[model samples]
Target chain A: AQTVTQSQPEMSVQEAETVTLSCTYDTSESDYYLFWYKQPPSRQMILVIRQEAYKQQNATENRFSVNFQKAAKSFSLKISDSQLGDAAMYFCAYRSGSNYKLTFGKGTLLTVNP
Target chain B: GAGVSQSPSNKVTEKGKDVELRCDPISGHTALYWYRQSLGQGLEFLIYFQGNSAPDKSGLPSDRFSAERTGGSVSTLTIQRTQQEDSAVYLCASSLRPSGPTEAFFGQGTRLTVV
Candidate 1:
């Protein structure tokens, strides 16, 4: 079974600053995908970024990027120039290449301060 | 629909009662999934359906939870003898296929409150 872990329960970042949310996972599958999802006050789960285990290069989406260290089994999300709107609950997820189910971390609540 | 849709945005039922939650996946999606999200907790996988095949109910917390997909499009998650622990937001997602790394589109979710 694959399991994702987010050590930080809560995080705060000042406006216009950068923040990084840490995530780790345990999976025996060699082929898999990692994802970061954001849930705002509206409670809509929005995809932030994704990384394939085979891809050595990290994934970047505008201000959101991921530092994926496959050997270390770590995939961390970095939010650059954070804004108030970035405040939300962030979840790290993992899906095996052969399965459709996603294993998610406990989640980290991010609060952007002005 | 352009996106996944779920019915009964909110449901409140007494303990031991039965409840059903519905989900309408994307127009062309062939894979649908059910997950439960508790307050301040991560998503708990419940079931998975691919086309018309038998669903993968491995993630179901208990036998009290069951789901079925009809016509490879709409799905219903039923909970028998609901318990207070079952109170949570039931989320539905759909992807293009049953395997691989496809982006999943999620619905607003049905908040089930068993008192």
Candidate 2:
């Protein structure tokens, strides 16, 4: 069984600043995928960024990027130039290439200050 | 439909009563999934449907819960004798593939509040 962990229960960042949410997971599979999904107050799960274990280069989607350390079993999400819209409960999820099911962490509530 | 749609956005039911939640996945998607989100349990996968067949029903919490899909489109999750702990947001997602790195589009979710 694979389990994802988000250590930080809450995070705060000022507008235009950068913030990073930490995530770690336990899995035996050699190859897998990591994802960061943001659930706003509206309750829609939006995919922020995705990273594959085989890829050495971190995944970057404009302001959203990931720092994936496969050896350390850590995959952190970095949000650059944070905006108000970025305020939400961010969940770190893991999926093995062999399975369709996704394992998600407890989530970190991010509050972007103006 | 353009996207996954869930009906009865919010459902409030009495304890011990039965409740049914529906999900309409993407038109062409062959894979559908049901997940539960609550303060206690983050997001847990309940079942996976590959074109109306559920190969994985591992995450369902108890025997009171069961889900099925028909016509390879809509799915229904039924909970018999619901408990207070059953209160949570039931989310539906759909993807093109049953395995691998495909993106899964999600529905707004049905907030099930069992009182």
Candidate 3:
């Protein structure tokens, strides 16, 4: 079984500043996928970014990037030039390359301050 | 519909009563999933359907909970003798393909309340 952990229950960041959300996972499989999902008050889960375990280079999507450390089983998301739209409940998820099911963390509520 | 659609955006039922939740995935998507989110439990995977067949059902909390997808398109999750613990938001998602890199698109989700 694979499990994802987000230690931060809540986080706040100033607009135009940067924020990092930490995530860790436990898995015995060598190949897998990691993702960050955002859910606003609307309760709609949206995919923010994805990273493949085999890729040594981190994944970056505009202002969103990740710091993936395979040996440490860590995958953290970094949001730069943070905007109010970035405020949401962020979840870290894991999926085995061989399977489609996603295991998600408890999530960290992010608040962007003006 | 353009995205995953879940019926009865909100459902409130009495304890011990049966409840049914429906999900209609994206038109061409072959993979569908069900998940539960509550205050106590953040997000819990419920079941996965590849087409009309379920490849994994391990996440179903109990035998009282069951789900089925028909014609590889619509799915229904049924809970019998529901308990207060079953109160949560039921989310449905669909992906274009099975496994690997495809990101799943989610529905608005159905908030279930057992009283």
What is the lDDT, from 0 to 100, of the residue B12 in candidate 2? 96
- Compose the digit string of candidate 3's lDDT tens values, residues A11-87: 99999999999999999999999999999989999999999999999999999999999999999999999999999
Ordered list by DockQ, greatest first: 3, 1, 2
Q: For candidate 1, write residues B12-95 as lDDT tens digits.
A: 999999999999999999999999999878999999998888889998999998999988889999999999999999999999
* B1-115 per-residue lDDT for model 2 (tens digits): 9888998899999999999999999999999999999874589899989974645888899999999998888999999999999999999999998766678888999999998
DockQ: which candidate is best?
3
In the predicted model 3, the residue pairs found to clash are none
Candidate 2: where are CA atoms >4 Å away?
none
Interface RMSD after interface superposition, each candidate: 1.0, 1.2, 1.0
Tens digit per residue, CA lDDT, model 1, A1-114? 889999999999999999999999999989999999998866678889889899999999999999999989999999999999999999999999987888899999999999
Taken over the whole model, the C-alpha lDDT of each candidate is: 0.93, 0.91, 0.94
**Regions more than 4 Å wrong, model 3:** none
For each candidate, what TM-score against the reference? 0.97, 0.97, 0.97
* Model 2, global lDDT: 0.91
* Residue runs of model 1 more than 4 Å from their true location after superposition: none
